[model samples]
Target: MASLLSLRARPAPRRHRWTAALGVTALALAGNGLLAAPAAYADATASQAVDFPTHCVPPPIAGIPPIDGTTSAEITVDKAAPKVGDTVTVTYTVTKPAAGNPVDLALPADIMTPTGKVALGGAQTGSVTVTGPKKNPPVPGKGTFPPFSMTGTFTVTAPGSITLSPGDYNIHTSYIMELDTPCTVTNPPAPVSQTIIASPQPGANERAIQLGTASGKPGERATVTGTKFTPLADVTVVGRAGAAETADKMTVKASSTGTFTAQLTVNDKATTGIVAYEGTAWNADKGAGPAAYTVIDDTPAPPNGQKLNAAVAAGTLSMTQAGDTVQLTSVDFGKGGAATGDLHGVTVKDFRGGPAGWSLTGKVTDFTGPGGAKIGAGKLSWTPSCTTKAGSPSTCAAGSAGVVGSAGATLASTPNGALTGGEFTAGAKVSLDVPAFTAPGAYAGVLTLTLT
Candidate 1:
């Protein structure tokens, strides 16, 4: 029998070698003598160590595609030349590709000054609405862009003073669309420029006519001056008496500096009170000034018992009088009727022995009614129709009836040295202005006629 020897196995090596080329790790195992390492054990212990990358390189983000579009604008001014303090109208026309979605557009404007560009006080904005096919038929995931054209108008006031020089200026405006939408868009288009001309203020064209004296006696001369008229233009100065212009007129040529002076004499037979003097230059400019002249008794005092008789013609109208005093009683103003009545066939005879002429003056007091209600004295008026005059009575009524003043309006008068004991006949009409809401009561007033 073979001698059997028992042997204990030793521990394996603590460190192992890894071969990168063979992709295996080698381990050494200790055993008793005569034991050769098995090939299977050595193959199992040899294992390869594989290394992996710790950091990774990320991919890039996807880019957004740009939307192609175009923008254009045109500006026009209403006035070719603008003056200071003038309102300038700016008309703007814009054309742009409209996105299917609603978009806001900004219009930035500035005035091109001599120094530089100055921004406008208020900037404007416009809206573009994508409608019709662009809005109704959606292109799935893609946005709709449509072409559009629009117009807008605005106003700008020029400077009140001469701060801005008189020359050609440009109104510059940039049209831009807001890019806050979902799709990426291109930059806005170029700006638009419009030209305007500014002009200096013109001189005054108003002509002025002045009078030396506003009022003077008849046959008095008044100096008339005119300025700011057309140079070397013919200026006619005439006196207008009542409704008729006097034949006596003066025509003078304006000086080189547009100034003229002339003398206008009042007619000796001119009507008392207001007399209008008119000045006309170059048939385009005209001015008028009123002059009032008073006619008073400047002669010697007449003797006592100077009688003045006023009467109405028989068979025409009844006349009531108290010692050469004609009374107009019972003026009936009917309900809602005209405040007018006729005092038929009135006559006056002046027997005063005086060199100066005499006038019939009507004095009216307030119309007093019951309950202390009164109508104004100015509301009562009298119109004298002097139809017949003997001894050349200077009748106040020439073409129309003379309006009687409440205090002492001239009704009829005798010409100077013409009333040498003569009679003047006149037809009279009286009017009383009554309000619609007048109280229904008896109203009474006194109208006294005196010679002056």
Candidate 2:
């Protein structure tokens, strides 16, 4: 399903659904030995004094005058400190629109959804648009427009402090003249309305580096292996023969497993002793560390060239995910809302080749509304599946259908055995079932996935 760049509720056939405009509060990763309780967002609330120019869309009729006003917004965020890549909710409450002059108006209370953009600065740049839950009260002759609010969500892409300030906004009136007002911020607040610090994403990949041969002659070809490194990052490996001389520079990209192999000709002039291999990455936290190799004298080879060989170590078990967001496109009263697409697969690799078994489970927090109303977690469910990779056992089974809530529900399990040492991907079709009487608004929920 195609995702809307931003959702602003217009006159639609659906009557009771609130557009999902804001990010959910918190997300936790579960299971022992895994990073737990990593908050996905930072919580904050602030009121800023602001001034903007209102472009009151003129009506077709000659008698009615256009609407204009100066305004300020109170900004609120649910998470105070979030991890990078996590989505967070941002809300804005604006002071009432003071009319340009007095006039008679019949404003529709349910149809006109406010839309606008909030400027962002500091660690993250760009704006979050507000287009959501619609409500407007009718304005009697010379009467005041009440305070109005809008909500939207943005995913934090980097780690550091972010500053949010009020920006352009709009107000739509469904009166006889169809007057709409669009406001542009001329003088933004001195200090930003909301500032949240974001921490680094948890469970970053980094593991022991490997080399094809522990000892090899100078100017020879050798391979390097590694795991648990950042995925899809560019890596450069260098071989140094001595304190003053460099040997070779080989560059390659990390595989999905965060693994890479770079083969280079050892520097011909490299001192005949020990050589060091060092790796570096531009985008990841750390690169494969340095390793040592021996360079031998230029001895003549046997009838068949001497065999260049090395023993490999037992590998470690690891799990990886493709991405972080899940989307549920529409919600209804009885049928609720089903997620639009299949979750990106979470893969588990044993590589350990041992008898240890593993299990993956998931649970979700209740869905929360902007006004503090909630749709319970029990309303959500999923249909799960697991598929084995080339070397994986055909035995790991996907967990049964899950009614996700506060308690844990199994997602996939591998039984204890030697054959259990395989790789597989687990995924689900997540959904929500909202009650008819639930308040209409965009709701957010946290999903926690755990493995052991």
For all candidates in order, the CA lDDT equals 0.34, 0.55
- The pairs that clash in candidate 2 are 42-79, 42-80, 42-81, 43-79, 43-80
117-216 per-residue lDDT for model 2 (tens digits):
6667765666765554567665555455566777656655556777777777766665554555566565553247777888875764344566787566
**Cα error of candidate 1 at position 99, Å:** 17
Root-mean-square deviation of candidate 1? 46.3
- Model 1 earns a TM-score of 0.26
Tens digits of per-residue lDDT for model 1, 202-283: 4423566666765555567767787777788777776644333465467888899988888877663443322222244212
Superposed Cα deviation of residue 261, candidate 1 (Å): 2.0
Candidate 2, lDDT over the whole model: 0.55
Q: How big is the positional error of residue 281 in model 1, measured in Å on the Cα after superposition? A: 12
Candidate with best lDDT: 2
Model 1: residues with Cα > 4 Å off, grouped in runs: 1-76, 82-89, 92-207, 269-452
